[model samples]
Target: MAGGMFIFSAVDTQAKFLTDTLHPFQIVWFRQLGLVLGLVFMLSYHGASILRTAAPGLQVLRGAVAAGSATLFIFAVSYVPLADAVAVTFVAPFMVTLMGALILREPVGMRRWTAVIIGFLATLIIIRPGTGAIHPAAFLVILAAALFAVRQIVSRALAGSDNTMTTVAYTALVSVALLSVPLPFVWQWPTEGWQIALLISMALMAALAETLVIKALELAQAVVVAPLHYTILIWSTFYGWLIFGDLPDLWTWVGAAIITATGIYTLNRERLAARKPPQT
Candidate 1:
């Protein structure tokens, strides 16, 4: 999971780099291109059975949410600082906890609820809504985080019936089909050889990152792997400083620390709860 986060951070950094010349939609489309190719290869090897799903509608919904989350995130990062954008998206775990309680009827204890409140407060520190420091685009990342939360909830629902490969395959197919709709309108062909290479690299990295995440999940329990998601902040911070010379402000770091702390606590609580005997 840590390795996957690092790769994803690289993918985000590359997307930010490409945003200099390409639309966010175009970048997202390109990123999904590699996933489509990978899915095609898997289909050829495993046969069409790989795409089979009992919940096709839910899978489609998950794909749409994934597509929206990816596009919104790319668009947000294009305008906002990488670390700041990433920090805002950290709220997804909190959002997931809340959504699970309300939508999935999963019992959320008081401790997790307190952590959720603190996590959102931490996000506000980065957003600074009333202050002039906030960019209008920062809100886009928050929305993207919400969409990501929905994706997570759907993933939990689908996990009982569908295998990981089917979920990944459907996401790739749906996102590619959705993005391909507007791709032609916003598409700007890469002019330079390096730009072409970077686009291909971004696509390949995106697919690799997804595969790594799936493997990581399979290899470990979700609670055990959850904390590794925080590693992206470190990678994002490093890439932001090294590539873009963008350093997060003290408040951003402070806020991120709070969010990360609360997120770990929340995960730990869930882990503990999962081990408890069910109430009769």
Candidate 2:
């Protein structure tokens, strides 16, 4: 998960850099192209069977949600600071917990519920609606986070029916296809060699990050690895400072700390619940 987060941060860094010259939609489409190419290479040995899934509808839905999430996030990052954008997206875990309770009918204790509330409040601290600290674009990150939570929910539903590679492949294919629909209107081909290289790197990093995440989840318990996602804030802050000369303010860090702590707590609670034996 840590490796995956770092790679994703790199992808975000590239996307932010490309935003200077390309539209978010174009950047997103290019990122998906890398994912598709990477998946093709990674699964080449497995042959076409690797793409087969019993839940094609659900897979397509998940891919569409992922496309929406990616587009919104890229758009948000184009305007918002990387650290701020990342911090706000951390709210997805809390949203996932809520959705699990309401949609999955999973048991969520009061303690976890408290953590959820605290997590959201922490997000507000970062956004601070009435204050000037918040960017109007930050809300796009929040919306993206919500869609990401939906993706997680759908993923949980698909877990029993499909392998990891199948999920990843379908997502790449679907997202690329969906995002391509707007290419004619917003597409801008790179004029410089460095721009082309950056776009390719962005795609490769995005694909690599997704694969690493899938492997991490396969190797470790979700609760154990999920907390590592907070590491993205550190990487994002570093990249933002080093590459863009943007540092998150004191309040951003404070809110991010609160959100991270509560998110970890929430995941820990869920892990503990899973360990408990079923009630009669």
Candidate 3:
């Protein structure tokens, strides 16, 4: 997860820089293109059976949601500082916890509920809507985080029906297809050689990061490694400072700390809950 987060941060940094020249939609489409093509090659060489999924409709829906979440975050980062955008996105885990209670009918204790509320309030501290401290586009990060939560919910639902690779492959293919619809309209092919190189580099790095993260989850309990998700904030801050000369203000740091604390507490609670013996 650590390696994945660092690479993912680099991918996002590249995407944000590309947004200066390319539309977010186009940037994301290109990012997914490499994965899609690789998946297609594997399918062709192996067999069509490799693409089989028990829940095709859900897979497609997940892909669409994933595409929207990625695009919105990339778009938001174009206006919101990288660290601010990443800090706001930490709300996704809390949203997932809230959605698990509401949508999955999972029981959420009062303490976890309070933590969720505080997590969102901490988000407001980062964005500070009324104060105009951050761009309105920051709200898009919240919307993106909500969509990300939805993706997690769908993944949980599909866990029994599909393996991780099937879901990932479908997401890549579907995202490429969906984004292609708007590609022609917003598309501006990279004008310089470096821009083209960054596009390919971003796509490869994203695929690598996704693989590392999945592998990490496979080897470690989610609760044990979940805290590593916050490490992206560190990388994002470094990249933001080194590349854009931007840093999160005092309030952003404070908000991030509260959110991280609440998230870690919630995860620790979950770990404890899982350890409890089954009721008679």
Candidate 4:
């Protein structure tokens, strides 16, 4: 998961760079291109049966949410500092925790709820709403985070009924299809060789990161894997400085620290709960 997060940071950095020349819609389409190719490979290997799903509606919904989330995120990063954009998105796990308890009937105790509340406060600190420290585009990241949480919830629901490949294939197909609608209007052919390279590299990295994250989730509990996302902040900060010569100010760091602390605390609570024997 940590490795995947690192690659994800790289992918975001590359997407931000490409945004200077290409539309977010076009960049995301190319980003999804790698996954579409992987989907083709999966289909060939597993044959048409791989696409079969008991929850077609959920699959389609997840795909649509996935498309929206990816586009929103790419669009957000194009405008805001990458670390700030990513920091705001840290709200996603809190959303997932809340949704899991409320919608999926998963048990969430008071301690986790407290952590979730604190996490929101941390987000407020980063965004500094009335002060307008961050761009309006930051709100788009929040919307993206919400959609991402929905995707995860839908994934959890489908876990029992659908194969992982099926879920991934649907996301790739739906995102590519959705983004294709604007391609003709927004598309700009890469004039330089480096632009072409970055586009392909972004796609390959996205596909690889997707695979690693899926494998990590399969091996560990979501709570255990959740905290690893904070590592992206580290990579984002590094890449933001090294590549873009951008850095989050002191308040952003402070808020990110608080969010990380609360997230780790919440994860610890989950781990303890998982270890406890079932009650009579």
Q: Pick the candidate with the highest lDDT.
A: 2
**Candidate 3 TM-score, true structure as reference:** 0.94
In terms of lDDT, the poorest run of 10 residues in model 4 is 213-222
Alpha carbon lDDT of residue 184, candidate 1? 86
lDDT against the true structure, each candidate: 0.89, 0.90, 0.87, 0.89
Task: Find the 10 residues in a row with the least total lDDT in model 1.
Answer: 214-223
TM-score of every model? Answer: 0.96, 0.96, 0.94, 0.94
lDDT order, best first, reads 2, 1, 4, 3
lDDT per residue for candidate 2 within 1-280, as digits (tens), equals: 8999999999999999999999999999999898799777867788899888999999999999989999999999988999999999999999999988998798898999999999999999999997878778999999999998898777776777887898899999999999999989998879999899999899988888887887676666667788898899999999999999999889998999999999999999989988999889
Question: Roughly what TM-score does model 1 have, to 2 decimal places?
Answer: 0.96
| lDDT tens digits, residue span 160-270, model 4 | 777778888887888888889989998788999999999999999998897787667666777788789889999999999999999999999999989889978987887
Measure candidate 4: CA RMSD.
Answer: 1.7
Tens-digit lDDT track for model 1 on 1-280? 8888999999999999999999999999989888888888888899999888999999999989989999999998988999999989999989888888998798998899999999999999999997868687999999999998888677767777888789889989899999999988998878999889989999999998887776666666566787888989999999999999999999999999999999999989988988999889
